[model samples]
Target: MFRWDGGPVAGGFAPAPAADALRQWRSPDGGLWLAAWGAEHRGTYTGWCVDAEAGLVLVADASLYDRDGLQSALGLAGPVLDAPTLLLRGYQRWGEGLPQRLDGDFAFVVCDLRKRCVFAASDPMGMRPLFHRLLPGGGFAFATAPEALAACTGLDARIPESRLLEPLFNAEQLAHFEPEITGIQRLLAAQWLRADARDVQVQRYWTPGQTRPALASTDVDGWVEALRWHLGEAVRKRLADGVRAGVMFSGGLDSSAVLALGCGYVPAGRLQAYSVLDRGNPACPETRAIDRVLAATGVPATCIDVADMQEQAAGALDALAASPRFVSGRNGFLPLFDRMAAASGVDVMMNGIDADALFFYEDLLERQIRAGGYAVALRCARKQDRMAGEAWMVPLVRRLRYTAHLPPVVRNGVRRWRGRASEWPRLHAALLRTDACEALGLRARARRHLALLRRPPPPAGGLPTQTLHGAVNLDGIGRFHARSRHFGVEMRCPFLDRALIDFAAWIPLELRLRNGHLKWILRKAMTPHLPHAVAWRGDKFHPGSHFDRVMLQPVLEQVVRDFHGSGPAIGRWIDRGRFLAAAQRWQAGQIEAVWELKMLLLLEHWLQHNADKVAFGR
Candidate 1:
């Protein structure tokens, strides 16, 4: 609710008539303060500092200051400062000077008034989000929500067509919209944007370290020890600041590892854990297994019964769709987390989202290809030519099925590949249309193309054949972060730490998957801390069970019907008859590709809603 319009006049901005009642808004002597109702129990707080003399403005999330001493440190300036201080905790940093030194789940903007310039950046992993819009008067405005920016400026609110198609056809585009709204754009992960009257420039402050240093012949033990140390450090850093921190524990290896690492840092009763489950879900046993681990670890944990929260599902989806990102119907489980986080008054929610992708890339690809090859080989052996005409269909069907059974590593790889791969054709076509490819800065495009050209080598060991599994995990992480931010809740994935990822990248495939087990190295390292039952759990619990349950709620049916009637963009590519048939099949308990198809349908609806917001012109 904190509002400010520094357009050379006081109280010039329009009033927030629809602002939530729990909101607090203030523009302090040199800064702006806004707090609003967040998630279910917790509230979100943000602050912005405007230094008129130096022309620098600093904005940040309020929850990031439990231990950084940033508040007190910045408070020393007492309303005015000799220079400018834009310090953010729990966010990614950009640029060389003040930006590179900062880290955590965050994104912020700084306006240098003296230089007539503005700058903004997002976290390295793109966990947090910040979006900007160029106003009709040649000035710009930024906000945490697309709705806020659109409401504040004279901008259109209609959804885009690509928003729908992107998620259905190219799932990774769910991270941010295409065409980026003519005068609006999102700060890319690990990138910074600076704008002045003279010019505007955006630059990447971080990049994945692909050139891995070779592992010394005798450094195997040392490498393991280092990996453990870095993992532990990442967990500990997240636990700092004395703020109430909780884990999205599934009793799986990754979450268990996070819980174990955090156990040493958080006090006995202070550590809270949350899980979601459907009473009749087949994965209930796994949730129970996770309960056993949490009980043994002595951390307080809660398993939210999502089946009871039927009415809240639609509202959750609406909130998620308000952002520029794609809303996968799969995230119906997120509302439970949001409600629990709000009710528990917990601020920081740690998740094990990226562990599988970072560590199990090899295993994922092996599984996919193995499954794909098996299907291919089976068909060949049977002399079944039915698959010949639908070459893409075979892999697509196999890939979708493989997703449900994928280990964390393979899941992550598929999400990443799918996101990047879907963009390949479009990027190529765009480049072909434009003669100034070099002038447009297509280096990232080139890198993606090269990666696609490098055909995945055959698995040397007993690994999965699916090379695209990791991409799936990556997309999930991206979607999770974007949606979490939408509700004002911060979900941090410790295993996705840049340091841990870089180190894991160098780990040879042989060690990643051995003896047909996924994440073997991590499992081995966690043996001393995690119970054997938790450490060696063979099957990954399907979080989608609760999602499926929510999908059956009558409200969701109404939502789907309403979206269809609203002329949703998804209606363009979706065969309404096919979608309706799939929905009926899902309702009859014959859910398979129907759920995925529904997700595509919802994505298309979202795209149609935001069609005009894409910024292709800029």
Candidate 2:
């Protein structure tokens, strides 16, 4: 605990100049030392705050959407306070209840000197990352990004053993494990923490359920219209007053919806689409859809051909080799950010990141079938299939097991007969050592991953589908936010807005996946504004018939080549012979997936680059 009265201090407070972040403002009585750094863009300030009189110092990576509303509620009347100051004032009035009254993507920490307590929280969607560790003597350390936090108190900057323990080659599995960084604990979406001299506590501040009962009562057409209205309002709140805006478009429903709605808010010629054109792949997924959206919307866009993607992966990997700690998928997008910086174009880039996972609840469909017999479920399934452009028999056959629900025994048997126990196939193929699977309990972990996938919707809702999918996809969103900010571009995902996600919870399942389609509700709502090609697109184009294997071949190669130098950090977890064999196949472009490569590379990078910090035998 920090000492207010000059007694013998257990652990002292001071700033590390070498940390290169978190400038300190010392208390008059040396009771606390607060460090803060902030970004000020177009009159919005998100980074730093200190209210000496109130005994609270705030450090945040934030974007407050409803500044006026929050200010009015807090009864503050004056020149607009910076985001951090407004939040501190919110804390002053609401205390730990402050985050509930707030909106937007943010991660913040408030050190209260008078109370001798530290408080920290993140936005419900985890668009911004927050990692911290409570110290033994009630001290604490945190960093928005990992590299800077390595030497701070209460963190271990080494690869977690579970990371090496599990050989993750599946994309979904990799995404699940991606954010389990070494050392500091990442506060998940909707989570907050409090610490004092006595002990520390962490808990969720959000209560999940349909946000608007009135909106939920509306008919299909009425709700669809309401979706459009709510969506436009969401986009408007995210846009800066006079800054240019762009959507990270993929010719998909979610981004298309964002682009369509976002256009209404961004000035003409000021809205752009940052697109990736899948070239050299005959199955070019986005080319046609991109063209249609561009033509229909008449908005300017910058498209990059995959053929023009040259050696950017290598540079990003090399940057990792030079820095310690893990960097997420954002490292792979350095080239895109580079291009944006070169054009000196958009200051804010929006994306459809979580819209895919957040829009619908898969298990809700299963529950619907189980609760109602086949006859009723058949009708509901037909309605969904008809709307989604799918054959009625498809959804019907997949769900027939639920029809035997009259007898619990028969129903259980029928379901068991319909599906095998969920497990990762070829899990051993990822291990270098044959016994590693049994030795590490990898099979059990795989089952848990499957269980996460098959998890039913939370009775209430807080983006159940995404949250239940093992990892909240926070790995991607958090890294994207950190990296974009690193390049001085404010990244916003309107889909991750707490308000929008809450609105999604109330949406009917039939509306979300009509006609064999996903994101059906969003597609229908944006149909008038988006080109039909993009609005009703069936699937996203996967370059090289694979996701990252081809696009990031250079980075993969760099990771594989670096494998020759794998030390105990990697050697302890992965089987060298087995992993290298796969790497050899990957080098020849013969492998379809190499999801484990990035995780290995992250561990290898930290071990090699942070040689001074590593203590394998300690």
Candidate 3:
């Protein structure tokens, strides 16, 4: 475990010893690097290995990294290798050829004295964070968290006011830090950076791609079969570790597909499935559906009732504020998952997180619109009413209602010019600007959509679609990875494996959203492996639903009190009467407007609390 002066630190160090040691190690050539924090009992250490022959440095949590595999893979001499080992034995994993090939959540930096270079990298999804500051001297200083570096070096930790505003107007951009913080940036996902005295180079090691095959005839069945093959292989690769892996099942099509594929790799009896259910929630019905799928697959499953443990939700909020990514307000799930994983003795936790963006399905209307098949588009749009209760209709309705709230002129123009040749571009632009995109906190969705539309249609019809989905998936994966780092758990998203993503990219949009259903190809491929009910089921709960009941109530009350209190950031940006009125409306179940307001309130607390520690630069 590595410890620095910022964030939460665990260890047994007196105030004087800890402060002095940390200060000495903050200089450019200071022979120390901070690592991730683990449990409270074990004190963290940061220092360099003196031996020239010391191989790669492996720092990880106790739960994930395998010691025997590390020794074998790294070609160590004996049970007690000469090299110094930071035994985050359970959390960090290293082995010969394993470091490069390993997937899932991790952040690591290996200083190769032999090569006189330091190689650092984070997981493809960026579940772990490593920040580096190029010093005035020749050397570079790095740490697991930015706050740690700031604390050690006496630098400020303040974020830019613009970054604070961006999330209000464009919540999706919260994943990125404000550009004003000089010399501070996150390591990109799937990228490796090497720094030596002479130079530093960063390069991406993986890219997800799919190319449509040139065919004399359109054979949809061939595409479907190929998708299944690649997806199965993806799941198998993730289950490579002999240790048991657990799936975060939701009974939805995406998770069911992952669960089924996982079961195929591990024996049914050995595979463990987990799901979260908020008791008394209307969405709990999905949990029952998940139960049915578990029975059909014969996989052992555990359901964590989140409502039963609401207190943990408060802790999740505080942790999120300390780390400060786009606060999802749904972070309570992290603690819930951790408690379950620790209890189950599970090392790897598989989730269906990236499925939405990777295997995104355009509604039936979108398919026809893309084809310029107006009649078909109209037919599907009208049938939307008849298929109102179907699985795909809810998101579609959300999209429509969200789009309807645009400025009066824009909304009226769209309604009047429906289906006209001259109106196509205008209508498309309006739909792209839906408020749901903003409400759901999709940060750069608009900018990305415009970028995609500017490009000419692909010759083979794969690149454009793949680029769109890949960007969205990468952003979500990046955020998920960040949150996992905050929670001290390694989160694995099976759907994000390069092979599975490529397969999803290649599957035709028509097959993905046939007959008004989303994720059709995935559902069809896993039909045999999953229960019929689960295979056909639709409807997903916004895990953030309980935010209003559990979090917002306390947060709003606190915001009001803090607004009245002196010396908080809330007093700076929030107007007293307006903020109070919004809180009252939110209390009356006007939940749609609560998210951005809640984010602002949280930011206020964070800024006030960290004002002294964080330094802002332009």
- Please name the candidate that would achieve the greatest TM-score relative to the true structure: 2
Best by lDDT: 2
For model 3, residues 1-618, the per-residue Cα lDDT tens digits are: 222222232223222333243322121232434333333111112233333345334433212223355555555566633212523221135422233454344566665434545667665555555677665545556666565665445565565543443444333433343222556666766677877777778877655553445432257777767777877877776666554677777677777788888887776455688776666665566767776887777888776555664665665456545554434334345545554564566656677776666655333333334455454434444454444454344455445445533455664456444423322243222222334334433334334333322322222334425343333445555565555444444556667665455456556656665654556677777777877777766545544445334654566677777767763464544445666667777778776546536656555645645665333322
lDDT of 1 by residue, 349-434 (tens): 78787776667653443444444544433333232224122343345434545554556577657666666665545443321222
Looking at candidate 2, the ten consecutive residues that score lowest on lDDT are 4-13
Q: What would the TM-scores of all predictions be? A: 0.68, 0.78, 0.67
What lDDT tens digits, residue by residue, belong to model 2 across residues 290-399?
77888877888876665555554444445455433345452344435434642575677788877766775435555445545445546555655665455754455365
Better of 1 and 2 by TM-score: 2
Residue 537 error for model 2, in Å? Answer: 2.2
How far out, in Å, is residue 265 in model 3? 5.0
